[model samples]
Target: MPILRRFQSRVKFFKASEYMQPKAEVQNLKHMRTSHLVEPNLVGKHTLHACKRLVERILTHKEEKAYKVGIVGTGGVGKTTLAQKIYNAENLKGAFSNQAWICVSRDYSDITLLKELLRNFGVHHEQGETLGELSSKLAAVVWGKSFFRVLDDVWEPEVWTNVLRTPLHAAAAGVILVTTRHDAVAHATGVEDPHQVDSMSAEVGWELLWKSMNISDERDVEDLRNIGLDIIRKCGGLPLAIKVTARVLATKDKTDNAWRKFINRSAWSVGNLPTELRGALYLSYDDLPHHLKQCFLYCALYPEDSTMSRDDLVMLWVAEGFIEEQHGQLLEETAEEYYYELIHRNLLQPDGIYFDHMRCKMHDLLRQLACYLSREEASQIILEN
Candidate 1:
């Protein structure tokens, strides 16, 4: 029943497996309008277009046939971004009678997802309904209607085959767009030709770095070009890594000495990241001001893909004494400033679905790093349900 389970030993913790899924009470959510899924200003425009082409080729469905397509990539490689672009494409307007965007976290609950799907279809299920009842309600809603669904951040194929596929297939015609970190998940979910999102090239990576920092001066470009490329190389062409590193650079003085000092930071050389995303993630955490570090790491306690409201985070930080008292500021105000700072540093991402400053989410990889660091700091920080 724990969202995150721990081994009997005090030090080791693991997320709840899909089978022993956590229970989530369904809220009566308003229909998810495509207008609400605001697309972030993305880098690598060419990749977006290419991904769109792939989706179109597979899902165009001139005869209203059902299609299952996937956009697969490593964490932070922009799979979600591509899916958003496709979801908002002008040409695809009016092609489906209804659409829904669901964020399927690592430990998804079948009943919760079924309820969410019905919510997106503008249907409300009665309390105490069985899985059979929820499925029937979902099937009724999609029956003979054209549907489009975006299942974002899916972890396992069973979430599709065992939970969603049956009811959704009742549509007159439908297209299921799945975004995942594993190609196996895509294929298992019926995405026969999942599109693999490649890492950014050196040129695009530098362009993204410069754009993120608003660095356009010809002399500045020349000054930082070599060091910037080296930084990008360490990033391994991951957009998330490049952007996080850019935030760290943006806060430093734009001088060769200052830039060199940053590039030579010791964290870059060592630290275990999922793969090539090594130092950039650690550097982002390391560069955080001491006060913000605790606040940022505390976020790792939440489940992956979890959204936290700004007020709630600020209050939590205040309760835990993570916020320093400013001479003329309320603790809440200081805590709020910390929240915005994390967002500025790209340590926290704005929850796109809500489209407001009130809520934000931590990237999964960042959360993992935070959890790892938290465990290292206080061996007694035991995770339980």
Candidate 2:
């Protein structure tokens, strides 16, 4: 079998319950009931707009042998979002003959990363090929072509220094964009001045909160505006916090009492180190229904920035007995409902670039929180190892 087919086979095997008897068959899930591609309402995203213009200028006007740029920020500060916007810009279409977006998360081996890059660039290689063989194949593919590539969530520098540098050395005109949390990684990728993404301002946070609430009435907006601003200040103007906080508030009755109750919650005033923004995330996690909690936490088992297939996740949930039974519904169907609920609550975001609603990725902060909450289980696994 070919490499891709074998990979699919392994995934199928992994999704099956190894020690349990066969269970009732559940029909494969169809289309997603709701879209999770909701664009955040960043009020006057001046920095983002300016960054796009800069990317265009570098890629279109620069005459370097191989142009590179980096976008660096703390997790949840919208580095990936900015890169996505630049990747899909309309004005830049047809500017390069080849383009690809590769998510290089914290856990990536050199060979696997190289293979993924080849796959995205429409190159094929045998399954057991050695590193040198793959490298030469990649070199041949980009030998004389103008290509644009986005490497998202880079953690280390070896991806370029060890694997990509030699292969891409001969490209006619290559433009590479990298998004990372570490300035070291950005600099190692040869970017002297990586664009830094900052948290939103107080004003922008309010816009995000109000937009997320989907509130319509001006009177209600005015009435809650003072309390809303006060509560948003606790979020520290982080977009992720404001958005998750809005989801929490949206569940309550739209009244001063409800908003006040949320503002007085303990999560809003806890930590100042690592991330003050995590308070909002904890609130969102706390708000999950019992069954959905298991499903949401289970997602943290995936590597950082990795996308999980909705189908495989639901099946695993069923196998783990996480999905509670509902009247007149199959377990898979019920599990699918849980999956969509997490997405609706913004605990899971649709992978907008690579896959549609069929796959989802959890924000790194949210994943960290999940792992923290499940530290006992993690500890047990560590001891066993």
Q: Which numbered prediction scores highest in TM-score against the true structure?
A: 1
In model 2, the runs with Cα more than 4 Å from the true position are 1-42, 60-62, 269-277, 353-356, 376-385
Model 2 TM-score is: 0.83
lDDT per residue for candidate 2 within 37-149, as digits (tens), equals: 33656454666675567567666643455688889988877777677677767766778877777766666567766776677678876867888998889888888877777
What residue pairs clash in candidate 1, if any at all?
none
TM-score of each: 0.88, 0.83
Model 2 scores worst on lDDT over the 10 consecutive residues at: 24-33
Clashes of each: 0, 0
Tens digits of per-residue lDDT, candidate 1, 274-355, equal: 4544688988998887888888877776666666779878976786777888998999999999999999888998765664
Worst 10 residues of 1 by lDDT: 1-10
Model 2 pairs in collision = none
